[model samples]
Target: MLEKIKRRIEKHQAQPIGEQRTFAVFLPLVKVDEEWHVLYEVRSNHISQPGETSFPGGAVEEGESFEEAAVRETMEELNVSKESIEVYGEIDFIFNQSHHIRCFVGELKHINPDQLQPNEEVASVFTIPLRYLKENEPEYHTVTLKTEYNHDFPFELISNGKKYKFGKRKHKVPFYRLPNQFLWGFTADFTHRFIEIISEDTNFLEGKNEK
Candidate 1:
């Protein structure tokens, strides 16, 4: 049995445990007027979260790498070819029991936000100057998480049964109030993380707008 387990481990590719839906997003940075700007998409009515702000990204398909999915989603959403995009590198990624999101930072050459034609998934495209984002701070909110169990769950198997003590884990949601847009949730977390890296100050964003 030990030998069999050793053989299995040799061929195993380590990945996140449990079932996870993988995703990737490209933080497309463009140079406008000698300054850098970050582009975002407003979800159109065709998608579920219409009018919500987001970056170019989608689910990672089977047999596709993280970068490949990011680039493919960018091309399909922005209506641009892969040749127009130059992927610099990856910053960091997010992993949870249900989701794994990877972010890639790169530049978009020879094009502006107004020039690109987006797909049905995109309602419109807009740009936020990196300098402006670097200057402004975002808000953070911590909310409680609901606890539920399967109806068939065996309550008698554990001590205290229905009154058993369970650890409290709250969700940390972020909000970025741009001049005209309101960014929040996981997307906001990604944006805040990117800013932290580029600004070289992990604690740069304080709770100025916390609630």
Candidate 2:
């Protein structure tokens, strides 16, 4: 039994239980006239969530690492080569009940946004200065997530039955107002958190920029 357990554990990768969808996004930093900017993509009209502003990324493929997925998606969406991207590091990740997103930060070298023809999944690409993002604040919306039990739930089997008092959670949905774009949802949340870590809460970005 011990040997069997060891084998099974060695083969198992830690992941959330039940149905889960994993994703990856690359935050591309482009240096323009000595200022750093972050690139974003507008989803194509034919794709899901068309007109929404998001980073260049997509789902993680089988047998691919999260970093590789980010690079592949960026190349596909932006029509760039892997050599053009210099991945600084992985910053933070985001997750929900059914979705897990891994994020990576990188710099795009020697590429003009206007010159590249994005794939069908991307309608257009735009960039915003990182300094502006660090200087501003994002508006937040709080939402409560309440669990709903199925009618056939076996409450009798648990110590807490119908009156078991399942816990409810509160989530903060962040919204960032751009000049001509409405950046919100998980995209906005990730950006906001990134800025907070490097600028507001920590001096990481500043330190990185100095060197």
Candidate 3:
């Protein structure tokens, strides 16, 4: 088994990176009242993207495996022990121009609102029924990407550089509506993939109550 793993690793090619960061996030599926729901964390106002909703994760630390970083971030944000989390598998990789994200799906051993101990990094925690996501689709919007160069960039260095016009890139972002909350960007994208994965197992999802 070790030899096979080593062979696979040796043959794998790392993705190219040009100052792009890597992050890992775990989607925690908690069973509550015979229904499966996904837990989401709201970033504290003091942190980046304050008040924005996201999964329990952050940038991968140096020399840390993606799975390790995912689990560590979950534990830190949720204040739960490692034993409470059972990582199943990873879904598709998410990437933008500036960063890459790994989304891991996992089950929470216990689900109790009172037991949660969110730290300063997290403003609040909430759960949405998985059935709702499976039944609904996110609204998509196209946003244009603009590029800006530094003031010191020398236009004289390259021929016709001053006259060069950069083309605009369009990105489609999806947003999901819940009572009063909105799930968009990376979180919504990850949820969409999760719904796709679970939809394949009719028996598993049918066991839970939808609503």
| TM-score per candidate | 0.88, 0.82, 0.86
lDDT of 2 by residue, 122-158 (tens): 8888888888888777899999989998899999999
CA shift at 198, candidate 2, in angstroms? Answer: 2.7
Give the runs in model 1 whose Cα sits over 4 Å from its true position.
201-211
By TM-score, how accurate is candidate 3?
A: 0.86
Clashing pairs in 3: none
**Whole-model lDDT values for every prediction:** 0.86, 0.86, 0.87
Query: Which stretches of model 3 miss by more than 4 angstroms?
Result: 1-15, 204-211
Worst 10 residues of 3 by lDDT: 202-211
Instruction: Write model 3 residue lDDT over 162-183, tens digit each, in one string.
Output: 7877789999998997787768
Q: Which candidate has the highest lDDT of all? A: 3
lDDT of 2 at 63: 100
lDDT of candidate 1 over 95-183, digit per residue (tens): 88999999998988878788889999999999888767888767888998767899988999999999998777798889888777758
Candidate RMSDs in Å, in order, are 5.4, 3.3, 5.8
